[model samples]
Structures are given as C-alpha cells and as structure tokens.
Target: MGQDISQIDSNEIQKMLQKFGKLDEDNSGALSAKEFMQIPELTSNPLVERVIDIFDSDGNGEVDFTEFIRGMNSFASKGDTQYKLRFAFNIYDIGKNKL
Candidate 1:
C-alpha cells in the first residue's frame, strides 16, 4: 500500500486530479457516495458501496483527493502485484476477517 505516487506520470496525475474535480460536483474537496456513483462503471456494480468504503480509507464517509489517488494507484499496471492482491482481497473480505 506504500506505492509511491511520484511513480505515476505527471500527466496522468493531472488527468486524475481533473477527473476527481469533475466528480466532486459539490466542490466539497471530497467525493460523496452519490458522486462516486456518478461514474458509469460503478453505477451498475453490486459491490459499489464496498468499493467506495474501501477507497474512503479514513472512514470519513467521503473519498478525499489523497484517498482517491491511492485507490486508483492500486490498479495501476506498474503497481506492486502483492499490494494489488492485498487490496483486492480487502475489497472482497467484507467480514473484515481474512478468509
């Protein structure tokens, strides 16, 4: 989970920031569940709520810029396989117990 954000291309980071801004409709500097659901890919997913909760690392009920970046980074092709595995495991381990 300690993937370095600096490893991501500057252009990619800028693009992600811009996307995040667009998703933050209320300009609250964080994305609410409604905002997350605005993404078409997530709208139909049965696990959307759990995905959002995982991304909202602080359990603050919203995904802030840092949390958003970290979550996205996990799926980056260059990210560590072990880290990605752990992240994916966490996503499906709804019980909070390693299954």
Candidate 2:
C-alpha cells in the first residue's frame, strides 16, 4: 500500500517546507499566484488558482505556511474514499470569494 500521507514525519515536513520556501520567490513567507504557478506539479492544474484561493484562509490573496500546511493536512488525513472526496470538496470550496 502507499505510505499514509498523514504519517509523514518531521523530516518530511521540513523537506516540504523547504520546497515551499523555494517556490516562494519573493521571500514573502507566502505563495502568490505567480509563485504557485512556478511549481511543476501545479503547472498544468487548471484548478491551481481555485486551490490557492480556497486555502488562503486569511483572504490575503496568498497562501502562507500555516494555511498551506492546513490544506495539506486535510489531504493527508487518513480516510476512506468517500471521506477523502468530502475533504477534497471542502478544501476546494471557495465560499464568498470571487475568483
């Protein structure tokens, strides 16, 4: 079976944070739309903007480390297929925010 994402340890989290740092080009401790687009994984994702919009909880127009990790954790949590789907929907739902 694939490794459980929620089981990721500190080292892995650190690595992810480091990657996030690299993606945050302006050193603003947050990822703006342009910076987010620079990530190869998200390059072709049509919903990248929506995903960032959803995760940018502070309505700051950027995703900070906390919001980033929270969004990641939502995906990482152990769950059945239905639960995972719900999580995805919940995260992807950008309420009251114009995109």
Candidate 3:
C-alpha cells in the first residue's frame, strides 16, 4: 500500500466514515466484533474473525476509526494487479498454510 492516506478522495473518505458510523452501533468510536458482524455481508462470512484480527492492530477487540480508514483505504486502492492478488492471497491464507 504505497498510496498515501491523502491520496484518498474527500468523497470516499466521507463515504467510509459513514460506513464506520453505521457499523459502530454503540457509538463507542470503535467496532466490536459483534457490531461489525451486524453488516449483512460479514454476518455470514467465515473469515470475519480473521479480517478483524488483521485490522485490529491494537488487539483491543475493536477497530477504531483510524484503523478502519487505513484498512478500507488499502482495500479500495486501485493499485497493481499483483498487489491486489497478493492481498487476496493474504486474506485467503490467514492460517498461513498451503491451501
């Protein structure tokens, strides 16, 4: 993720902020796994725990706005195919074992 946070458009930032707000039901300024799972897409995802683990760098069992923004920015970046492929693999191979 060579792209700087400044590179993200203002509109996109606002959009992501809105999403964060929606997910943070308790308004604690962070997303607990229960709150995160509120999203219908994530509700059924088997790897949701790993996804949170990858982004919740502080291990506080919650994802703050900054962490949320950074993770979303990387996911949203329009970068090289190889970079995207590697990211996909990282998500797929969260167990660090051969598939």
Candidate 4:
C-alpha cells in the first residue's frame, strides 16, 4: 500500500485533461464541486471533497486543470513511498484510503 496513485502517467494525464475539460462547464480551466458531481463515473469516489482538498491548495472552492496537474505532480513526486504515492492517487480506487 506504499504507493501514490497521483503519479499519473502520460496516458492518465490525457484522460484527466479530457475529463477535466468536459467537467469545466464554464469553459474555464477550473471546476467546482457542483461541476464535479456532474460526472457520472466520479460519483463512485464520493471523496470529491478530498480531491478538492488536495487540488485546491489555495483553499479555493474549485480547481483549475493547471492546479490539478500541479497537485498530482507534487503528491506523486519521486522518492515518495509506493504506498503513499498510490494512496494519493486513484491507482487502486477501491474506495478505501489505507497505507
């Protein structure tokens, strides 16, 4: 469990971007909880607040695609324990956060 799922790869980045762009209803590069809940698949996470918690570093109510990437990069930085890395990311979205 010593992994950080935030270490998204190139493919994952593309997917994330596509999903983020679609979720940004205002055509802005950011999204809010209201905008996020619109995603059918994301309902499973139920921890959208946590995602917002991490991505919204500025304590803002929303996150821009740039902010998302920045958060992902920081959480998934090299030298992080595998479990921590995976824990921070969706590597194993079993709906549980354990390390």
Local accuracy of candidate 3 as per-residue lDDT tens digits, 1-99: 232567567898899899999999889999998887786766888888877776676878999887777666656656345645655676778675737
Q: Which ten residues in a row are the worst by lDDT in model 2?
A: 1-10
Candidate 3, pairs of clashing residues: none
Error of 4 at 93 (Å): 19
Clashes of each: 0, 0, 0, 14
| Candidate 3: residue 49 lDDT (0-100) | 82
Q: What is the C-alpha lDDT of each candidate?
A: 0.85, 0.69, 0.73, 0.64
Structure candidate 1, residue pairs in collision = none
lDDT tens digits, residues 1-99, model 2? 122446556775786699789989889999998887886867898888877776687888988876666555555544345545654675556584322
Output the better candidate (1/2) by TM-score.
1
Best by TM-score: 1
Error of 3 at 67 (Å): 1.2
Please give, for residues 21-95, the per-residue lDDT of candidate 1 as tens digits: 999999999999999888777899999898898889889999998888888878778777887898889889999
lDDT score, candidate 4: 0.64
> Each model's RMSD to truth, in Å?
1.4, 5.9, 3.0, 7.0
Give the better candidate number (2 or 4) by TM-score: 2
* Candidate 3 segments exceeding 4 Å error: 1-3, 77-86, 93-99
- The better candidate by TM-score, 1 or 4, is 1
* Tens digit per residue, CA lDDT, model 4, 2-64: 224455677767877887888898987788878876767557776766666666657678887
Q: For candidate 2, give the lDDT of residue 49.
A: 81
Q: Estimate each model's TM-score.
A: 0.89, 0.69, 0.74, 0.53
Q: Give the CA lDDT, 0 to 100, for residue 80 in model 3.
A: 44
